[model samples]
Target: SGSFVVAVDTDVMGRGSEELGKTLMKGFLFAVSQLPSLPKTVLFYNGGAHLTCQGSASLEDINALADKGVDIRTCGTCLNFYGLTDKLEVGSVTNMYEIVETLAQAGKVVKP
Candidate 1:
């Protein structure tokens, strides 16, 4: 199939205060969702795992991606470490094995 995979490395969009960082992250995801062709997968890891769970400002956009047939996967270990395992909403909980495999097999791996 013709698809791209995007990996999110951190919860915040860029470097700065937590509040500003979160705002940027939300804007980024929302913008991505508006693209005519969405990514096939969106992998969330590290601090980025927080963006797929409950209470995330970007939850609506992320859920829209899921509805559009994107595979939204969040790292299980990261979620547990962050004490957010129970908060996951829009995606599957994935382990490191799957994460590495998904990235390795993606047509394109965009980190943002």
Candidate 2:
């Protein structure tokens, strides 16, 4: 299958109240995990780093995706920038180069 990827650049899914956006993000990730064909990879960067770290509300859904072989990656610099380097719970650290290459190679890219 072609490389289908999802890039999440923020902790929230959209504009509006922070609470509502976070709720939407949780629901969105859960829905993604339930997809018949999961994305080949999920890239977490910027505020998205929060979603893959410990204490995150979406850890369960993200972990479920990981269990099914989705390549979960969180930006190393972003984590450090956010003081979350030691809090990561579900993915390997990646850099901008890898992120760029992955996105460039992806057949489709979904952002939420």
Candidate 3:
């Protein structure tokens, strides 16, 4: 099968009340963790970086995905911009070059 990659650019899925969005994101990640075949990598940036930070409700699901060998990478610039560099809990930091390269190399790129 072709390699699959995911790029997350938001803290939530839709433009709705903040509470509902976070709830949906949590459920989405939980469902991703339960997938029999997971993506090759998951890239988090912008507001999505918050999902991988400490105290995030989605941490457990993200951690489980990481533990399953999915490459989890978050934008360093994004983390720094949000003052969350020290709070990253589940992934390594990546730069724009690698991010672009990763997306370029993937057979499919999924954004959610």
Candidate 4:
């Protein structure tokens, strides 16, 4: 299959209720983990940075994805802005240029 990537720009999955969104995000990650064909990479930025760091409910699933060879990356600038520079639990830091390249080079991009 052609390479695909997931781009998360928020800590939650949708707008409105924060709790519901978080719950959905947790489930979303878990569902992704169950897929036979995994994403080539998962990029976290903006509020999405919170999901790959400490205190996130989705950490276990995200880590599982990482363990399975998914390239997990969180924006370095976003980590600093959120004061989570050292709390990254699942992935390494990445830059804007890399983010752009990843998205651009991907055959398909999924946002959820």
Instruction: Return the top candidate by lDDT.
Output: 2
Give the Cα-based TM-score of candidate 4 against the true structure: 0.96
Candidate 3 TM-score to native: 0.95
Model with the higher lDDT, candidate 1 or 2: 2
Each prediction's number of clashing residue pairs:
0, 0, 0, 0
lDDT of 2 by residue, 1-112 (tens): 2379999999898998999999999999999999999999999999999999989999999999999999999999999999999999997999999999999999999998
Candidate 4 lDDT for residue 58:
92
Candidate 2 or 4, higher TM-score? 2
TM-score (all chains, Cα) for each model: 0.92, 0.97, 0.95, 0.96
lDDT of 4 by residue, 21-87 (tens): 9999999999988899999999999999999998999999999999999999999999999999999
Ranking by lDDT: 2, 4, 3, 1
- Tell me the tens digit of each residue's lDDT in model 3 across 1-112: 2299988898888886988988888898888888887999999999999999999999999999999999999999999999999999998999999999999999899886
Window of ten residues with lowest summed lDDT in model 2: 1-10
Q: Which candidate, 1 or 4, would have the higher TM-score against the true structure?
A: 4
Give per-residue lDDT, candidate 1, residue 18.
81
Residues 13-81 of candidate 1: C-alpha lDDT, one tens digit per residue: 777698888888888899889988889899999899989988888899999999988899999999999
Q: Tell me the whole-model lDDT of each prediction, alpha carbons only.
A: 0.88, 0.95, 0.91, 0.93
User: Which ten contiguous residues of candidate 3 have the minimum total lDDT?
Assistant: 1-10
Q: Assess candidate 3 and give its lDDT.
A: 0.91
Off by over 4 Å in 3: none
